[model samples]
Target: METTILTKKDVEKILTMEDTIKAVEHAFEMHGKGLTQMPPKVYLNFDKGDLRAMPAYLEGKAGVKWVNSHPENPKIGLPTVMALLIYNDPETGFPLAVMDAMHITNMRTGAAGGIAAKYLARKNSKVFGFVGCGTQAYTQFMALSMIFKIEEVKAYDINEGNAKKFIEFCESKGVDAKIRGIEEVCDCDVLTTTTPSKKPVVKEEWVSNGMHINAIGADAPGKQELDEKILLRSKIIVDDLEQALHSGEINVAISKGILEESSIHATLGEIIVGKKPGRLSDDEITIFDSTGLAIQDISTASIVYKRAAESDMGIKIKFFDF
Candidate 1:
């Protein structure tokens, strides 16, 4: 059997944030309507890193993403997150393509944030605040910019140099971008936290009314970004109930017995499917706790595979003797 192998650059050449947004939105709709099958993500923890296996089947596509997060890698000049995606033929149970998934993860996560903003953020939101100026932060900015006419960007990172680089990139994109203190960044119209912090770095008082927050960092158990008071006062939305309750931003709060499962207003999928409301009032603060979904990976992979095929990108290798 012949399988297509695509590199990161090959996949990046054909992927667009706008297309990814549509694909991820459809994935959410399918997930919300119960048309997709995605098992809960399974994890294997290490002393300093963790690996996750996320598998799903949706709209005739099947795939799995094996990804890892090593917080200390940056000190050694490596990325903190790396991923590999495998696509399969759902009908024949045959392997189709193997591709680099780091970019896909960034794009889909950013797409989820943008979709959440579309449904939850106030229409007039113009200022965007990004915490943690990494590759994921760039994608989040790109995706949000695709949806909103962002006028200014405020960035903060543990490494001031990294934050300054992100600001320069954003400024080159024609947005007024500046590196700011953490508390100052939290005061924007939309705040996205992507730092790998176990403790809450954003205080409750910094958040203002009508602010929409994309809590992107807490994808593992014990990781949290926002104070419990922020969740208590906001209309909390999650990507998946079981996953988010266990690993998303609310996980720490739930474990402390301060937040209840019933207090969660709705899942992002529920809002997309119109089962639950999004933002009720103009002054209501909304938070989208994003635990990345496998359906998102599968759906996004399907698009990349299609585009690659049409453009004749990547290498075809024979790996099986049948």
Candidate 2:
């Protein structure tokens, strides 16, 4: 069978940030509607880097996709992570397209953060603090800026030069706020961490009351950002409990005996579906444990596959010899 191949630039043209937000909201809606099937991700681990293979399909959707996450490639001038999306022909279950997935992965991740904040953050949140100044940080900023009336933003990284570069980059992109140091960002209403650091980036004292944290980097076991004490002070919410138990900030807390899996207020999905409440009071500290769900992969893939076909963006392919 002939398979279609699409490049990263092509995907970027179609999957804009606004589209990503709506797609992520819809994905959560699908989850609330009970229409998704995802197998556990298979991980290959090492000291500084690893790869994850996540396969998933959404019920009533047209395709399935396998995505991966790999960190530690920037030293070699490459994206820290990448993906491969294989759309299948429904009639015979044959492969149709093999397309690059970097754009969509970043978009989906940003979308998840925005959605989580929409549900979890206090209604008056206007300041955003990002813990790592990188591409992922850029996307998170884009999504938040688009959805929230952001009055100020602060970002920090181990490399102060990198943080300055990000500030200039955001300034060029029309971010009208000052880019400050970690301690300066500690006062923000929302805190987002995207570094690959295995140690805590923010301490409990740094976080202010009613702040919402998006724990976006701790997707692997043994990877953590904020101290477990931050979790102890916050009402933890996860995308998925089982996944977070093994891979997100909860892993660190659980291992240290600071919190129990049962202590999680609710999954973000449950909050979306109204089974549980979000942000009950102005003084509540909320933390979103983002392990990066498989359902997110399938959600975007279905969108891209259909958009490509309708807009004639991908190549047509034949089935295998029969």
Return the top candidate by TM-score: 1
lDDT of each: 0.94, 0.79
TM-score of 2: 0.91
* Per-candidate TM-score against the hidden true structure: 0.97, 0.91
Tens-digit per-residue lDDT, 140-168, candidate 2 = 88888777888777888888877888778
RMSD of each: 1.2, 2.3
lDDT of 2: 0.79
> Whose lDDT is greatest here?
1
- Candidate 1: segments with Cα more than 4 A from true spot: 75-77
lDDT of 1 by residue, 1-322 (tens): 8899999998889899998999999999998898999888888999999999999999899999999989899999989889999999999988899999988998999999999999999999999999999878999999999999999999999999999999999999999999999999998999999988999989999999999999999988999999999999999999999999989999999999999999999889899999999999989999999989999999999999999999999999988887
Off by over 4 Å in 2: 1-3, 45-49, 62-77, 89-92, 319-322
User: What 10-residue stretch in candidate 1 is worst by lDDT?
Assistant: 34-43
Worst 10 residues of 2 by lDDT: 61-70
